[model samples]
Target: MFAGDQNGLQGDPRLKAISEAIRVVPHFPKPGIMFQDITTLLLDHKAFKDAVDIFVDRYRDMDISVVAGVEARGFMFGPSIALAIGAKFVPLRKPRKLPGEVISEAYVLEYGTDCLEMHVGAVQPGERALVIDDLVATGGTLCAAIRLLERVGAQVVECACVVGLREVKGQHRLNGKPLYILVEPRQLTNCSAPSVTIITRRDQLSYYSQDSEN
Candidate 1:
């Protein structure tokens, strides 16, 4: 389950395989909630590496100075990608998680509302930044992430995620910032099903969020 020392993988086939490796838990965190679980994908070494490689390859030479990952889930691949690109890893965490003086931005979620925090000086002015998350449902978290970075004068290059559930509210939420997704399983009403759309851009990823971001 570990793609320990190999990378440089490209194309949809590898991404599709990585998407397939992600497990979906029905009614998780709440009834009628189909929680997309990346822990399963994390177990697959090659899949995890491929995911990180995809982001690393794209940003390695983009002069991206900072890689900011959303709390919890985003922590999984953020550091690795930052390391590959020779950038610093910044964690945007939940309230009070950071011990230093921090700034916060509030956002709504598919389920509720929450805030994201970052250290006061994690990013400097004119620094190119990239935001990473495991999945984007309503995009509230990503939106807040972008705002947090911009407030500090960072140029948010793009927001990347493993999956995106299409939600109309997500549009204009980033104000033209590109949101890239590795995959969006359009159909697979459950984890047991076998259909997913491998997406590389927001236009395609929006196809999955018609009903709800979940």
Candidate 2:
């Protein structure tokens, strides 16, 4: 699972552990779908710590002022990363979810229209920021988050995710900005960006099959 996280250049046991925590279920929330259930990993302490540590270590050099996590799931690890880096945690939420005067950006999801909001002036001008999400399939959520953060004058240093699903076709929205992930679908089955490869097994041979085949 560290295949993508290592930029396809390295591997690690922690990555393998993180991958096993993610479950794959066929036809979830709808038909013809495979959802990466992160709850398995999220529930485990060591797995969650490893996942967060990867990001924390990756962005350690950057002078990150805030770590923004989107919604419910993002909230899980975002705050931990922020705490590790000694930065403030910002929450990106749906419309009206926040009580303050928030700036909002809307984007399309595979299922329906979605929106993300941040309080006005949550980030100061020229502030270095990093956005994290559990996963990125279409890049819609990440793009919307970048827009909302940039709207207030934050420099998006990078974007990261535990998994990326390279089938939805949305990486272009990042505009060449740095994107990091732990794993991608074993096969390039489709032209999807922000692809996420979830691993439910611990066997090294199966998880690294893609690298071996190449």
* CA lDDT of each prediction against the hidden true structure: 0.73, 0.71
Task: Give the per-residue lDDT digits (tens) of candidate 2, residues 1-214.
Answer: 3555345436577877887777666434433334667888888899888888888887777899989998867788889899989788999988898997888898765446778899887888899999988776557678888988988989998888787755444466776677788865432345232232322211111121222221
Clashes of each: 7, 11
List where candidate 1 sits over 4 angstroms from the true fold.
1-11, 110-112, 167-171, 186-214
RMSD of 2: 7.5
- The deviation in Å at residue 170 for candidate 1 is 2.0
Residue-level lDDT for 89 in candidate 2 = 92
Q: How many backbone clashes does candidate 1 have?
A: 7
Give the poorly placed runs of model 2, Cα more than 4 Å off.
5-9, 185-214
Quote each prediction's TM-score.
Answer: 0.81, 0.82
Give the alpha carbon lDDT tens digit for every residue of 1-214 in model 1: 1121222333456777787788765534434334567889999999999888888877898999899988788899899999999999999998989997999998764335678899998899999999998876556668899999999999999988877655333535786888777765334553542233222222212223234433
